[model samples]
Target: MAKRGSRRATATRQQRNGKQEPPLAGWRLWLKRTLVWGTGLAVLALLFLGVAVVFAERSLPSYATLQATQPGQTIVVRARDGSELIELGPSYGQWLDPDQIPQPMKDAMVSVEDRRFYSHFGVDPIGLARAVYVWMTGDRRLGATSTITQQLARNLFLNSNRSLDRKLREGVLAMALELKFSKQEILALYLNKVYFGGGAYGIESASRKFFSHPATHLSVSESAIIAGLVKAPSRYSPTADVDAAVRRANVVLSLMREQGRISASEAAVDPSAVKLKKDTNQNSVRYFTDWALPQLEVLLPDTTEPIEVWTTLDPGMQNAASNAIKANVPKGAQGALVSLDRDGAILAMVGGTDYVTSNYNRATEAMRQPGSAWKLFVYLAALEAGYTPDDRVKDVPVTIDGWSPRNSGGSFAGEMDVRSAFAYSKNTVAAQLGNEVGFGTVASMAKRFGITTPISTYPSMVLGSSEVRVIEMTRAFAEISAGGFTVEPYGIVKVTTTGGQVLYQHEDTRKAQLVPDYVAAGMTDLLQTTVATGTGRAAQIGRPVAGKTGTTSSNKDGWFLGFSSGITTGVWMGRDDAKPVSGLHGGSAPARAFSAYMKVAVKDRPVEQFKTDLKLPEWQMEPDEEHMYGDPGDYYYIDEQGNLVEPNKPDQAGQMPFPPDSEQGSAPGNGQQPQQQPTPAPPSNGRPGDNPQAASDDFLNRATGRGGGTTQRTEPRQSGPRSVTIQPTPQN
Candidate 1:
């Protein structure tokens, strides 16, 4: 024991003198080596991360553009009063301050999206572990576990491509963003940059678009609704599918309640009661904006700069028109309505039922046969050719070029005056007059009034066989409203940059007279007979009205074009595929739609008479005594199909196929009786106007919160005695 102790002491003494080391010293040396290696590896990892960050920072989109508060970041469209109408940009909404963000909104987002948003350092380790487990098992439907800061980083500087490289780069960038921006700043950016659907790119826009209120005023339910859209905006859009949207919002509310962010009572509000205000900037607004967006370049010369456009759209008128169509038109059948001032400023335009479902602006894009509506140009040609409204015209059936034109009611009124013929929508008179004036003259008259579509010189051109856009037809009618002055339709009133520098200002483009004032006066007098005592009686609004009613062969297209002194509107309804509506006719849906819209549009505006020099043709006013139908009620009845079925007995095979409603009667104008058939039962829906089966299934589903079924609402008041219904022919 003494030798061992002496040896150990000597070894210690020798170690102190730099000779032999103790046995345990080897373990100490091994630990030191391990520490050094680990430190070097850590240093290398950090160095590599820094280099990668530098490279990624260089590859990012321009930082100034990303952080810009104007132009590239948010392009705001405004109403004339400087109210924001819409926003167009990848990142929209006001850049809210951290202090300005409501706590409830933040809490709801955090609870539903990332509970550790405030706690995590750019990335959550636990979340990463769980994500790995999910990914390894290929259960990708579990969604992502990215932190809010990380999402901001991805939204700002990262491509959404999924790859290990992208993920690493994202992680690096997320850490960098964390270092650069404080947590509040990061949260603010995230909130401002997130997409909330319905073309809204930020919380503010989403709130305004959905609730018609600003983000600062959003209620707890509203905030949850907006928050729930972060995952799939289009799928969860309130406008697209209200039930789905509410269901998602309920999920968010439940999460908030579960996380103790809200009280149970606060979450107990009925989801159905969370009524979203109807969006005025929907399809109708989009139609005008889309037409005006391309004009921005011509107006601005440099579209790169942010600009504000003042359009001619009257929000009140637009809303009225949109509501009118929505309230009156049945589902499945597409309808378009346009309201214009005499000078051709578009007051309102509704292109279709839902712009999201179908962007094809029927008012501007579709070109369909104008049916009897085309008779305006034909009558104008006849007037120019020295035909007076009182002149007697043969109403016997006539066929031109293998095409036989028939009126809505299949009977002929023989030897009726021109005014009475037009009032009754007599097909035989219209066809005969077209032949007399020459199709070329009629085509020329239509062109002079702004009908730019190809006008064939074919005889059927008199019957609106060739297609013309609704907008085009509207413009043509405006010329007559302008007292023969050519009116150029325009929507944009002004364009200016955000800095208030004017880029474009509207100038009246009304041109010199395109039609003789006398001709216009005569035509107005003739058309007024339509609204006063003819097929267009449904469109009367207790004022002087002049317009035409139109229905095509097989009832495929229906139209009503009428004008007061202040506004002229054209309404068209039909299937997109040209399928015939079961019992549809011009005098039904289109006429009532016209009446419904005008009744609101003309409110508060002074009622004025159409300016026309009533140069007495003296003879034009004489009622035809010979062939006059006994009573208006005897002339028509609402058929099961909603069409006005005339009881005209068929003539011999060679006689004119069937003449439309005859003004006088069947034989020579001496008060002769016409053959007739028993009237059919009216539509079972009790209303002559409503298409019960035409309501949208999707709309009904959302309204009732049941999938795959429809509910019927009571028929609205009708302006006429007959209703138009449509039945579609199957596609090949």
Candidate 2:
């Protein structure tokens, strides 16, 4: 019976493909099946790994290319005078021989990053096992699986994006690198390629960036601190956070002790006591370089070569602009400044108080309400419609389709010349002018002036309700300085490869005359009157200056656009969130930045006066209006004696000239002298504030007194009466 059953089973395993099969029993049969499946999988795995390796090898550069490759390439930016303003890419310090590398630094790096670096071949199995242990235990911080050699391979051959495919590729490269180079050679290469943050690449750059010394001069504490940065460069950067860096360095010291790289006594050295290099570039010119970087791609579309950029930036003016913005921009508020020549060369641009803290380039990127600064377009449009600056415009209250706009002081000065009304930034007058000239004409004027931002035709649009960039505003003012010719702001003088091949040279691209000469003269007369005795009086520099002051009704955005010393400058100040800033007024801080920056920026330039067909007669608000407005930031206010009084002039009344009865009119500083300190005054320019965001769509309602949302109030920190402001609420 058993023989018959075996025969039946054997019959099932009969011959196939003309080959007879022999029957096996128990473990033998199971072993045969296992061998077949295992061999197939092994062949597939080998094929997959081979293909991955081949793909990785194809992207690898030749040895010469690898040797020549910088962890990052640098672009040297030179100012107009050919002096170095800043280096635009990763900072690479002097290359060192293996002997020049300090032993302590090598020890710190190996101890913290890869203790088994020399014993293992690139991929450390022990470290990977620990990673597996960490993954299972849900302890992320304990798993640092990358070996030093693996890091070198990734830095040399890959990008920063993390993925499983990249990891597998990195592992293959690491193993190949181990075979091609000795342990010492790999370590040296790793040190030279790793990023150490603070714009630094390589160990040598890190040593100098943090310690202000070369790697050869580094002490054990400094070495450990620099070594600690590789794990998380920016977070552990001494320049960014000294406390965090010191804490990380302490951890590295403990690692060194565990690895026996340092004695217990040596590990006791206090890293916190180690003096680090101060950031010498607190006034970073990165603002200029950042603006110029993308332009290089446009200028040289075909080259991967590093280049030298000769910029229009004047180091002196850049320093001045940076200092002015930093000193004048109040705490919690941000400011941006752009200075351009009449031909539109950007001499200096400060995008914010500190580039290290926030890199949002407000000068070129932020599109906030220009306040009365936009009136440059409005008045220009009026001029285009044949109204002279001498023409009278009503400064009294006006209503347009149920939208009633009032003057800043809430008391209009009846009738005034167009220049005076503009000088005072009269919302009613500007709105009236827009209504007469046609909103389409206003939009056309803005477009002609290089303001590419979308302009709405609402009645309130005349009062800078539309948003524009600081650079665009400066360029528009520059065109006015250029006698009504269009000007486009340019920063790159030329871009050249390091080998002296010129790639791009800037040319005067546009000379289009948008407005007639008569209009330019009229606008100049108005701008001069503004600086001489209007809202922009704070910008006066004892010379022929033309400027305008613009403060949104919400006191959220302030602007000063002006021309002087053959240079046109625009300044903007506000919180990024569009929330109301306390005491923010165009006549105050923005003008102060313009003044501070221009005073030094044009100090060496020849003084030039504005060419005007008519002289602007100085005008002041009526005594009733002045008494009612009573803002220290106003250009001129009337005294009880009915005389024009300068609020900032101590000689006018032996003290500040603000109204004693009003809340915002208190005399500045001990009531003995007019304060030169830029006071945060009433930013309200009397028009309903620029509707921020979705609020913009509701501007018609808010301006016409239909619907409104709640306003965000910042506690008053500036020395002034609390600002009374109104605007359509912010949706962001």
lDDT winner among the candidates? 2
Candidate 2 on 521-580: residue-level lDDT in tens? 889989999999999888978778999989997899989989987899999999998999
Task: List candidate 1 stretches off by more than 4 Å.
Answer: 1-73, 80-83, 92-283, 614-732
lDDT, model 2, position 214: 79
Per-model TM-score, in order, reads 0.52, 0.56
1-732, model 1: which lDDT tens digit per residue? 999999999988998899784465687888988899999999999899888766755655453455564323345666645666677765366766778888888988888888887787688888888887888898856558678877877776655666778678678887777666678777777777787865577788788788877788878988888899999875677776677778898899888998889999877446676777775455567766766665664655534566677777888777788787777665668889988987778888888877655556789889989999999998886675445566556666666657677766688766666789899888777776665555665776787777889988777777898899999898888788887777788888888788998888889862656655666887887888988998899888888889999989888999999898679999999999999987677778888888888988888789887665644221222234322223332232322212222344344753422324434323444444446633322112211222122123443343324553433222211111111122211111
| Count of backbone collisions in candidate 2 | 0
lDDT of 1: 0.71
**lDDT of all the models against the reference?**
0.71, 0.74
